[model samples]
Target chain A: MEAALTAGIGTPLSRSAADALNSVDLTALTPGTPAFVGAVERVLTSFFTTRREIVDPLGPVFVDAAEALAQFVVRGGKRTRPGFAWTGWLGAGGDPAGPDAAAVLTACSALELVQACALVHDDIIDSSRTRRGFPTVHIDFEDRHRAAHWPGDGAAYGSAVAILIGDLALAWADDLVHEAGLDPAALARFAPVWARMRTEVLGGQLLDINGEAGGDESVEAALRINRYKTAAYTIERPLHLGAALAGADDDLVAALRVYGTDVGIAFQLRDDLLGVFGDPAVTGKPSGDDLREGKRTVLIAEGLRRADPESAALIRTGLGTDLSDADVDRLRTVLKDLGAVDDVEGRIRDLTHSGLNAIAVSTTTGPAKKLLYDMALAATRRTA
Target chain B: MEAALTAGIGTPLSRSAADALNSVDLTALTPGTPAFVGAVERVLTSFFTTRREIVDPLGPVFVDAAEALAQFVVRGGKRTRPGFAWTGWLGAGGDPAGPDAAAVLTACSALELVQACALVHDDIIDSSRTRRGFPTVHIDFEDRHRAAHWPGDGAAYGSAVAILIGDLALAWADDLVHEAGLDPAALARFAPVWARMRTEVLGGQLLDINGEAGGDESVEAALRINRYKTAAYTIERPLHLGAALAGADDDLVAALRVYGTDVGIAFQLRDDLLGVFGDPAVTGKPSGDDLREGKRTVLIAEGLRRADPESAALIRTGLGTDLSDADVDRLRTVLKDLGAVDDVEGRIRDLTHSGLNAIAVSTTTGPAKKLLYDMALAATRRTA
Candidate 1:
């Protein structure tokens, strides 16, 4: 025990291991965009591989949970947060070849784990059965329990285990940042962004649940939830955190935030649209999931506000219930007829335009400004 | 948003606020014993006060949840983890009046929030109705949902909100430590301990649920669960974290771990005893709650191993069932008749003695050795 303590436990990713995971010739591509996504993915893989080793001794069940998390992290999502963070770094003149590059990259990669933590817990909260076309973590565990004929309520067991797994992801997220090898001064600047991001996301989650319970249907209420729950966590803080890690000036950080907030809100509005109307094959979720889950999105809120009495009743009845395809189509048609869909699309366009305008006016350097402009469009226009 | 960002959000504990909260002349009392508890509590109050302010603008519902968490943190528990952490610092020759004293105290205090997080999540996992004689976080939220006629499954809503609250507590725990003002080197050392502590606890929790679901009643399995679940998180890691914060020598840390491991196990063994036979009023839980939860304790494992076939049948039948007092008493008689209770008591005595013996041989400085000796006995001998 003493020897292990002295030697330090949970060794960082070895150079060879990192190289094998990241065979891409990162130097050949542009930094902080396509190249940055691969870099972040490699770090996530390396970090999870090391974590899996640590949990390996705990036995197979523990290993199973850790592996599920690793797979979820390595294969899931579009790396949206880390992409923004990297672009933010680039915008702030952070050199990908600088001495602090590894640390910066590691810290940026940690965002995915935070996202993993959020989605895992959110699945449990929503009682979501699947994500990315795979069973949700809790559902996975619940199935494991049922197959084993475990001596408990399988759903409860699944939820309990998922909760802990989410907790582990959150813990390891901080660990990754701590082990990122940032100098103290850089770390000092980074800590508050990290803290605030966590608070806002968690707080936003609480607000979401609270609003659901209170049955608040106002558009302002929905947008407020989106600001903290999605915008701050998904974009604003990630970009701010990256700039902070680069020791960016206040002006740069603020300018990037303005763009992040607008784009983030627009991104979520796009998600709201996708949740109700996108192809399940592309979105990797059942169509009308937001409706089934009764998600209080800006689109829904606007529809409820703008619809006539009969249309409003139809929208309200279709929401938060097990909806058939026909029911979903009816709701969709009503939303279109009432101009709710157009209203939301207009907002998305306006928000995206405003976000691009912010980037256009900023003193962002090099290719980053162009990337930022492109990303705003891409993020809002995505199918999934 | 820019102005708020520039001014710095979530301000630290102000001096006047700290003074008002901690009116105790901490200098007059011993640094690491009774006095340390109050210091940690004071820091917690200040931290929560500041945190509440940050969440205040999120609206009343967010503030209400945050307040519940703040109350749980400030008023709950015996502060056992922080007590050991403070003692660990003292044993490592940390100066009570040193320039880093405030930072040390704040970091030590953060352990309580970690405990709050674990307990909050644990209650939801266990589906326990009450904790410390108060409705558990989930139950409180469930009641809130019911009272408000909230649309949704009240229990699910409660669990979801509690999960967010716990996550918030966890995120804030890290924030407190990060904002504690540790130097780069001290923070670097502190990082791994914090990381490992979280992993061990969460992993231990997984192991525990896995054990219960699998019905692995072997004493070895039970003890293994105890080793990681309660012992490491409650004692060993807290001490290790404090020692690391003080940059203690490896020898001293190893020695303290030895004592911590032994005492921590003994402490858990005592808890197992209390969970069954102790006064419900004193334990702040229902009588035979552990039996109802079907917790695989060393005592229960031993009883199953040692009992006759009919007695074993009795034990198995009673283990996880909802038992009347008569049934509980019958099970208690069978456990005692099997000598399991005696076996556990003897183990507690021997472990406590071994832990005290380690303290006697260690190079731990000042009054810490004596305090550790007393704490080992108190921890293992208490009824609750």
Candidate 2:
């Protein structure tokens, strides 16, 4: 089963991954745009630099934590979240060269900081040791503590420092957005979305934790978590906020939200698949890590319901345990045999198709629409 | 030395404590200024109620923490901080019943939340089990975990839950202030001060943790921490912000700051003395709890500096241990023998006198000045 499926799908997935990357014309951005990008970059850099300066006076402990946070943020990712915000502003017939663009970017930059805080704290909670192919903040600090012969358990010290750093990052994110100097009315409009995003993310975290504690792992429960935890915050809220800041009308904002919600869920579903099947070299994580972590994904729940009794027992026993290569292979085969993987993939295609349909009807077009389309496809179609 | 102090003082401290409480017209506040007082109370109640509603969806773990926080906040304290802010606003000729008043109280309410988060986190960091005669949040959660037979160490679970709760509170504090509906110009002016206040408090915490860890025990270092940690945040910034929002002239803001700084430091010094020597029944805690917890206070540093070599070594060794009642007695004797308690009392008197003098020379006198004067004396002279 493994040889047949791998041979059938491997080449097409690779081509799709390459095609998605190729669609984003990184070089097509005008030279004039970098000035705006540079301004946003400068503000973000200054925001974090000032943060480091402020925390530096606190002590070496605070300094170390703040430095780690700054480093983690500055180390490049796709910057897709901020880019979505910037492009959304431009798509609403707003000038990217104006102060509004800088303001939007500044707010967008704060999203990254917020993301860093969430990721750090999430890693601590999940007991994850690595992120983006590097040791997590807690692990990094723990290693330092061990090297320095600290008086306490190195892991505990690392966790404590990571918590404090996350707190500081959250505070700084708010401060940066406040100081972005946007129109008062616009900022007022954006405030609730920002506030709700934080609340939903935290609420989603609570839901995730509760599910892992062996309470109701129903489809409705997982979908609720996905909506609040990932979909709304990661995509819908950011687009709405960007649009709101540009004085976008309700219809446009509503359209973007529909588009965002579909893309967000599709993105997460794709991530679940990759977590189980993608190569470690490409994903920067071990294959089958989500299964080992016993993540309460829709895929797993579907698989559990559809599998034969003997197979279901095997999965229940093996779900959270560290699995050998052969064990992972067997679990993957069972999941495929139960048709859970195909079912999830089909759902992803439905969401993507719906998202594209929404985009076609959207009043917004040109570069912003193009970028959003590319992003939506890239988010859902990735192998990693 | 204890016998000598009892013989010399003749219970003057007890009388001063009673006189301080009697002097404040807290009851007269309701009848004379019902609208103003009502506004402040309404704002605080709504803030906490809204917070509880928002956190309710985060599930039982978060709901438990939120309820505990709401309960702690609703059991109101002196309301001196909000009173100072209102007095400052009114003293600067701002209407007490206007939007500015609500803004001031909103900001003041946030200060209380900030204080709650700090106290909760501080208890976790210090491993203390009680606050304000109630089981601390961490301890309360730990007890709940143990009772429910939850997985993991009860203490770790308690700390984890408390950390998240504190994060939520801090995030809510920023949201409340940002959404306080102040004028744009006023918000722009207030932003830097608000940012600085948070940074300073964190900075002060760092100084304190370091000083305790390093065993510095220096009077200057402890006072520096008090200035940033308590003095600036507690009094100076709140008053100045209220004044700034009201568009007070720089001269008036400067004058209020001078008065606030002195009173703020005096307030903390009084708290330190109460923690070490105040009557347990009156203060609602065990006597000499700070001594048992080995808080690195100015009084302790002064005692060590002035004590004989043998006594100094004993004091240094005793600094961070849970001392017995008899040991606390001996520690008090050592402090009194070195005249450290008397020195602190003298410093408190000087600060109170200076604060009153600042208020007297300023042209800002009115009901606000009278309120500040009463607050200064009460803060410096209180036993609890």
Scanning candidate 1 chain B in windows of ten residues, the lowest lDDT window is B9-18
lDDT of 2 by residue, B330-353 (tens): 988889888999999998898888
Model 2 spans with C-alpha error above 4 angstroms: A1-40, A50-68, A127-158, A307-310, B1-41, B48-69, B132-135, B139-157
Error of 1 at B225 (Å): 1.2
The candidate 2 chain B region of ten consecutive residues with least summed lDDT is B11-20
Report the alpha-carbon TM-score of model 1 versus the true structure: 0.93
Instruction: Identify the runs in model 1 with alpha carbons over 4 angstroms from their true place.
Output: A1-35, A52-54, A277-289, A322-329, B1-35, B279-289, B324-326
Question: Model 2 chain A — which ten-residue stretch has the worst lDDT?
Answer: A9-18
Q: What are the fnat scores of the candidates, in the order listed?
A: 0.56, 0.14
Clashing pairs in 1: none
User: Which has the greatest DockQ?
Assistant: 1
